[model samples]
Target chain A: MNQVIETILQHRSIRKFEDRPLSDEQIRTIVECAQAASTSSFIQAYSIIGVKNKETKRKLAELAGNQSYVEHNGHFFVFCADLHRHEIVGEMENVDLSSALESTEKFMVALIDTALAAQNAVIAAESMGLGVCYIGGLRNNLPEVCELLKVPKRVIPLFGIAVGYPAQNPDKKPRLPFHHVYHEETYQQDRSELENQLKQYNETISSYYKNRTNGERQDTWTRQMANMLSKQVRMYMKEFVESKGFNLK
Target chain B: MNQVIETILQHRSIRKFEDRPLSDEQIRTIVECAQAASTSSFIQAYSIIGVKNKETKRKLAELAGNQSYVEHNGHFFVFCADLHRHEIVGEMENVDLSSALESTEKFMVALIDTALAAQNAVIAAESMGLGVCYIGGLRNNLPEVCELLKVPKRVIPLFGIAVGYPAQNPDKKPRLPFHHVYHEETYQQDRSELENQLKQYNETISSYYKNRTNGERQDTWTRQMANMLSKQVRMYMKEFVESKGFNLK
Candidate 1:
């Protein structure tokens, strides 16, 4: 296997991190690498706010479902899906930016662009001997996150990422068999074969969680998914995004 | 900078690829790395279909706005926002999968999961001396792509990625200023400062494009955006997503 492939295959979400802070140079390099990722037609509709302030991190940690790792992580960044930049450009050009910011097309572009850039940052951080974890819980309080971050009308909080040196080596979580996800040229939903694959995957996941949690409830992947889906944790997202000027219409 | 960071920072989309095919082992490794990326609550709501058949590749190229790179790239992978697996699990469990597959939250999860995994694959491939380019034009014919690929309900085509050794050195595309995207704790629409930053960026982009295209009409960043937005490209995406059973309610 290629060395990069080897490194990526061994990836595990590092929640526990050493207390050491990332150097400014390191931060710059990671951000630059992130900026280098391809954007839709070079719009680059995303931004990362590096959070080093202890008080602010605590506040953000509270906002993100009280994730302690976020408060104490060596480096924290919040990736925003921003259309505000283009809105300003539109103003200077004496054009209406309202349609540009509100369109669903623009929202998709911003979200995808943000994800691509953040992913690059994650890889770059890992390559530089750093540990990282994405905090999707940041969306737990979307409006509050925006208010606290002082985000403008056309920019919304997408997700937060925490980066640092590893303090512990967590076990790699099991995934569904490749066949379960990979299809041919088109989408195929052959459940029986996938179910057969899932039987093994469920066992793998069950054992993984069991061993990791020291014999906690041996939950299969499906059961865990069911538990998650039953909750309406992100129900406000649509309205929130709309309020933030993303017209999904 | 770390070698991985260097690779990422120096990254460029390679439209032209060498004729050499990727080895099966290399493919396996890249896919494994992709799977290692974070999935929302580990639902892993995405899949990739590797295309090796020339006929299928040619058809896909035609479907994706006649991009020749799709047919000639060393490896082509179509990433799907997949909820089909969950639909099957629901059928077997006699549970409602409609809610899981149709919600906006679920769609966002699948999209983010697919993108994160694909980005990982890109990084890993690059580390192994491969080049990559994302094909957002794949969405140009969503239903056709779904029909041709035999995509099941609840699985939407998110994007395509082409990976292989580079046959040509493409120029690094310039990005908007960091401040244009990144904001502090809150969203700010302070236009004056942002516009100033954008002027510098516009100049940078104008010069870069001019040098690359050998004096081809040097369109400013804002002009390019206005031109793209003025045209209709993704106008049908909402309806297409709805047709795929993503009510996004």
Candidate 2:
């Protein structure tokens, strides 16, 4: 494989970091790489908040369920799905965009745009020999996160990226079998066939966990998913998003 | 910049593709790169559908508002936000995950996961000297598209990517001002300050359009946004997603 593909395939989430920060040039280049990603209709409905303040990082780390990596990375960037700017465009052009901006279609555009940019940022960081981890725990307390970040209406903070010099090189987690995640022309709907593939994958994952933890834990992917999904998470997300002036339609 | 970052920074949507198709190995490598992207809580809540059937592509092209690129690309892959597999995991574990699966939080996770993977695939294709375009026009008739693809419940066809050797190299569209999109510590909610930056960007974009189209289209970004958002597009999206057994909570 080529270097770019190699960088992508060698990816692993880095939770530990060295005691150093990225230079302003490095950060700018990373964001510039992000800006080059395709936006839905050039709406560019996203923003990156670079958290350099120690106090703010500390509070954010706490908000993200005490992830020390969130507080101690070379840089922490909060990627938000933002339509507040488009709202401004509506105002500047003397047009009403309330019906469109509040639609779920536009909401999906913002989310997808934010994610595409964030992934580009991740790849750029990795290519620069930096390590990164995505912090979905930011959703642990979305309203509080919005309050802490002073985010305005029509902007939802989706996730954060912790970028730094690597302090730990974790094993790359095995993904679903290639056949399981890919289909040809149409979706494969044979449950028995899919379950058989998952069954084999379950064995691989069980072995992975066993080896990773020195036999202390041997768990299947399905079991892990079941344990997590049996309980509702961020149950207020729908109402919270609506309250934040999104998806009100 | 490294080769990977260089590839990323040079990204532009390629709507015109040479008449060609990606080899099976090439397609596999692209999907592998996509699977390597970080997933929320390791959920990996997405799937890729590779369309090779001429009739299917032709129909999809029609469904996507007759975007010829969607029909004639070397390959068209539909990226989906998928919880159907998770629903299966729930069944095997004999646990009810309906509440969790249908939550808006889970919906966001699926969307984000799908987009991240799709972006990686884009980068991978670009690194291999191929060109790509994101076909958000697939959303024009999502219900019919889903039926055509035989998509199941809890799976959303978010968008399509058209990949191929480039037939044309378009100039990169300039993005919004860096300072306007990247904030420090907290979100800058000062509307006037934001508008001033956008006004400047409007000039840049206006010049770009004029230069690109030989003065045929000298439109500003805000004006374009105002024009698009004024018409309510895809207003059925919210009801459709709910009908697909997602975000029912």
Candidate 3:
């Protein structure tokens, strides 16, 4: 197998990191890889802010539910879903952007572009022998983060990436059996196969949580999904996107 | 730099293809690489439908702005942002899922997870010397696309990926300069710098479009942005997502 394929298959999320700082060159290389990722229609609807100041990181840590990793990582970057740059390009080119900025498809494009670019950054960091953790908790409080980061209109902080040397190796978590998400020709909602696979996965995941080298927890994949996904998490995002100059209408 | 990073830096959107089909082993390996990508909280919130049926691909081609590449590619996959499987788990576990499924955070998680997984698939394809193009036009007619793919509620087809052996090599489209997207410590709003940089990149891209071996055209990057993004693109997406049982609320 190729090195690129190998790097992709052996993926892990690193939360606990060694206390060190990433050199300027390393950060530059990572950001370059992020820029090289594909963009929809070449709009490049994304921006990343590197956060190194201790005070800012500390405040960001608080906003992200006080995850110490946010404050202690070697380097942290806020990946933003951005359309402001495109709007400015439109203004300079004298194009009327009213209808475009108001559509949900445009908003989805920005979100998808940001995610695709950030994933590339993740692979790049991993290939460099660095550990990375995606901080989705950055969305816990959106406005506060935007204010702290000075993110302008038509931009939303989707997630943060904390990069550092690995202080610990987390066991590779198991995924659902392949057939669960893969289908031939069309979507086959074989609930029975899914239910059966998930039931076994619940047991496997529970055992992993219980026996892992870190904080042992008692929960199955099923219990976690039911507990985490059924609740109103970030109920304000609908209005938040609208308020950030993104028309959800 | 490593071969993996080098591969990432050379990404190009492939629309033309040689008339051939992928081996079963190549398709299996691509799916495995996609599954191996990182997910938020291990929530692999995505499903992929492989479309080899000529009739289905033709219908998709019409729905996606009549891009013949959709039908002509060696392989095409509909990458879906899905939480339907998670809800099934919740039902089996007797967990109240309304709160989770009804939140905007949940929706964003699915979107991000799906994009991350798809990017891995793209890299995997490119590593195998196969060319791929992302069909964002999948969003052009979401309802019809959904009906064609037998997609259910809480499962949205985000984009389609067309993959094949390269029939033509297009120039790598340029991205905004690294400094334009990367900021130190905070978000920078430097319109003058951005405008200046884009003006130069615009010339570079215009020449690319005009002199490319196939379908030579005249359009600067800024002009294209103004022309393409200025109009109402995929205006039905807001209602479509909601109708599909996604809570943008």
Candidate 4:
């Protein structure tokens, strides 16, 4: 395997970080790499906010489900799906872009663009021998995050990512088997074959977690899904998205 | 700048690919890298189908608005927002996961997961000196693609990525100024500063495109947005998504 391929295959989310600040030059390079990612129709419908202030990081940590590592991570960035830039351009050109801003298509494009850019930043960070973890918990307090970030209308916070040198190396989590994921020329609903594969995956994941974190089996992947579903974790997202000026209609 | 940062800063889309085949080892490595990307709550709600058959590639090319590169790219992969795997798992455990599969949250998670993973694959490919281009045009004929690929319910084709050695070295496209994208502490609708920056960007993009394409002055980025909005490009997306079993209700 290629050296880069080996590096990629060994990737694991690093939640613990060394106590060192990223250089300004490194920050600039990573952000520039993010900006280099392709945007749909060149709208560049995303923005990233680098949070360097300690007080601000503490507040974001609270907002993102009290994740302590977020406060200590050497570099923290919030990626936003933004149409505000285009709206401003429209205003200057004396054209109406309200339809474009409100459309679901536009919202999807912005979200995808943000994800692409953020992923580029992650790869760049990793290549520089840095560790990174994405904090989807940021969405847990969407409204508050929006207020703190002073996000304008037509922009929504998608996720936060923390990047720095590693303090710990977590075990790589198991994925479902290839057959469960890679369908050939059509969608298959053959539950029997999938169940057979997933049973093995459940054991694989359960054992991996057990070995990594002592002998505490916190249920299988299925149980985790059920727990999340029963809790209705994402129930507020629709309202939150609307509040952020995205008209899902 | 670090070598990785340099690679990222110099990134450009390579639409034209050389007629070369990626080794099976390369394919496995890239896919494994993609699978390593973070998934929402570890649901891993995505999949990829590696397309190698020339006849299938021709049909996919037709589906993707006749992009000939789809047929010629050394490796073509379709990234999918997949919930069918979970649905099958549920069926085997005789567990009711219909609500999970039907939720808007699940659909968004799947889409985001797919994008993140695909981006990882792209980065891994680039690290190995391979070129990549994303084909958003895959959505143009969603139903046809679903039919052709035999994509099951709860598995929507998010996008296609064609990867291979570069046949053309396109210039890195300029992005909006940093200030236009990076908000400080909050969202501000301040346009005067951004508009000033955009004027320069417009000139840069115009000149770049003109020089690249035989004196044909394409409209500025702002004008491109205007032109796109005037059309009904995303007309079928809503219905297509609904048919894929996402209940946005």
Candidate 5:
């Protein structure tokens, strides 16, 4: 494999980071890489907020479900789905765009744009010999995060990336089997066939957790998904996104 | 910049491609890189469908708003946000996961997961000297796409990627100014300041289009956005996603 694919294949989230801040050059390069990602229809419906203030990072870490790495990272960058700029374009051009901006289509575009950019940023950080973790936990208290980050309407803070030098190397978490996630021509609809693949994967995952925790935990992927999916977590996301003036119609 | 960062920064959507099919090894490596992307909470809520049949590609190209490259590319991959696997897991475990699976939170997770994986696939393709374009036009007719692809419930085909050897090398479209897209800790709130930045970018984009089209086309970014956003497009996306058992809550 080439160096680029090797970097991608070797990726594992790093939670424990060394107590060192990224240089200005590193931060610039990462964000620039983010900007280089493809934007849908060239709308560029996203923004990046670099959080450098320690107090702000501390509060953000707390707000992101008490994820300590968020506060201790070399730098924290929040990726936001931002159509606020589009709204400004509307005002400047004296055209009403509220209907289009509020459409679920645009909201999906913004979310996809933000995500593509964030992944590039993560890859850039990793290539620089830095480690990164996506802080989806930030969505746990998004309204408060909006207030803390001074995020405006038509702009939703989707997630953050905690980037820093690595303090510890974690084992790569095994992914689903190739055939299980990849289909040719059409989706594999046979339940029995799918279950067979998953059953084998369930063992692989259970053994992974068991070995990682020294037999303390032996959870299968299915159980983890079942437990996580059975709960009504973040039930307010719809209302929250609507509050930011997205997905109105 | 390193090779990976360089690969990212040089990205541009390729519409014209040579009539060459990718080898089996190339497809496998690209999909493997996609699976290596970081999934939210290890949910792995996505799937990649490789379309090899000529008739299927032709129909998909028509379905995706007549994007000819989609049918002409070396390979076509549809990235889907899939929670159907979790639904199966729930059945196997005899636990109800309808609440979580139907929630907007899970839908967003699936969407994010799909985008991250797609970006990785695109990057991998680019690194291997292949050109790729994201086919958001697939959303033009979601129901038809679902029917044609035989996509089941709890799975939404978000977008497709057309990867092939490049036949054209177009100039990179200029993005928004760095400061305008990147904020320190909070979103910049001054309209005048923001407008000023946009106005300068407008000139840059207008010039790019003018040069590219030999003065036949010269549209500012703001005008382009205003025109696009003034009209309602893809009004059926929300309902379409809901019908697919996503964003139901």
Candidate 6:
């Protein structure tokens, strides 16, 4: 594989960092790389909030299930799915984006566009030997997150990334089998060997957790997912999303 | 800048392709790189369907607003935001994921995870001297497209990517300026300097479109957004999402 592919395939989420801050130049280049990602219909439809204030990070850390790395890292950024910029820019040009701004399609567009950009930033940070972790737990307290960030209507934080020099190297997590994730021509409903393949996968994951050095949870993939997905983990997110002015009707 | 960062920063949507199909090994590598992308809570909530049959491609091309590159390209893959695999596995483990299967949060997670994976695939393709274009037009007729792909419930096709060798090198499109995109500490609402910056940016984009070798159009960024965002594009997507058994509610 080529260098770019190598960098991407070696990807892992970093939750620990050394005692160093990212230079302003590094953050600028990362943001530039983010803007370089493709946007749907040139809408861009996203924004990045860089967090460095000690007090704010502390509160944010508490809100995000107390992920201290969100405050302890070299640099932290909240990637938000934003449509307010388009609204403001449209108003300036004597047009209104109210119709487009209110659709579920545009809502998903903003979220997807932000994700595409953030993934680029993640890859860019990784290429520079910087480690990053995505903090989806930020949504644990969405209203507080919005209040803390001063995020306006039609904008929501999808996730946060903590970037810095690596203080810990986590194992590269295994994924579902290739055949399970990829299909040719169309979807496959009946695979005769899937049961056998999954049995092997369960054993592999069982061993992975068993062999871990820290906080080992001896559980296979299915058991973990069964526990996590058995119920609506974050049901309040629906109401919270609408309360943020997204018409996710 | 390193080669990976350079490659990512210089990305452009390639809609035209040369007369060459990807080798099976190349396709396998691309999908492996995709599987390597980060997933939320190890959900790995996505699947990819590779389409190569000319007739299916022709139908998909029409479904995706007649984007002929989707058919003419050497390889085409539909990236679906899926939870079906998880659902099936849960059934095997005797844990029904009924509640998780219908949450707005999980819905968004699936979409974001799929996009993250697809972006990795894009980078990997670029790293290997390939080209790609994400086809959002597939949502134009979601039900029909899903029918064509045999996509089951809890699996929505987010977008499609057409990959192959480049037949035409499209210019990398310009984006909103760095300051407009990246905010420090928190959101910067002060617009004392934004108007002036936008004016300069408008000129930059005007020249970019005006000087294009193909279908030159003299338009500014704000003006273009104003025109496009005035109406509700893809208004039917909300109902279609619901029809596919995704409670995006």
Candidate 4 residue-wise lDDT at A37: 86
Tens digits of lDDT, candidate 2, B1-249 = 899999999999999998989999999999999999999988999999999998999999999999999999899999999999999999999999999999999999999999999999999999999999999999999999999999999999999999999999899999999999999999998878999999999999999999998999979999999999999999999999999988777
Cα displacement (angstroms), candidate 2, residue B46, comes to 0.5
Docking class of 6: medium
- Summarize candidate 1's per-residue lDDT along B92-193 as a digit string, tens digits: 566776765777677777777888898888888888899998998888888888877888778887888989889999777877776665554455567677
Q: What is candidate 3's lDDT per residue for A113-197, written digit by digit as tens?
A: 9999998999899999998999999999999999999999989999999999989887788887787888889898878887888
- Per-residue error (Å), model 4, residue B64: 1.5
| B1-249 per-residue lDDT for model 4 (tens digits) | 655566567778888999998988788778888898888888898988888889988999998899888989888889888887777666555677777677656766776788888887887788788999888888888888888888878888878889999999888887877666766556555666678777877887788889888988776877776667545577667667877787464
Candidate 2 error regions (>4 Å): none
Candidates 4 and 5 compared by DockQ, better number: 5
Return whichever of 3 and 5 wins on DockQ. 5
Worst 10 residues of 3 chain B by lDDT: B207-216
i-RMSD of all predictions: 2.0, 0.6, 1.3, 2.3, 0.8, 1.5
Q: For residues B157-194, write the lDDT of model 5, one tens digit per residue.
A: 99999999999999888899999999998788898999
In candidate 1, stretches whose alpha carbon ends up further than 4 angstroms from where it belongs are: B184-188
Using DockQ as the measure, the top candidate is: 2
TM-score, every prediction: 0.95, 0.99, 0.96, 0.94, 0.99, 0.96
- Runs off by more than 4 Å, candidate 6: A191-196, A213-216, B191-195, B213-216
**What tens-digit string does per-residue lDDT give for candidate 1 at A21-57?**
9998888777888898878777788878888889889
**lDDT score, residue A81, model 2?**
97
Query: Residue B198: error of model 2 in Å?
Result: 0.6
What DockQ does candidate 6 have relative to the true complex?
0.76
What are the lDDT scores of the predictions, listed in order? Answer: 0.81, 0.95, 0.87, 0.79, 0.92, 0.86
lDDT winner: 2
Candidate 2 vs candidate 6: the DockQ winner is: 2
Q: Estimate, for each residue in A1-249, the C-alpha lDDT of model 4 and write its tens digit.
A: 555555566777889998898988778777888898877767788999888888988999998888888988888989998888778777766787676677666767787889889887887788788999999888888888888888878888888999999999777788777666665545455666677778888887788878877887656777676556545566677667776667455
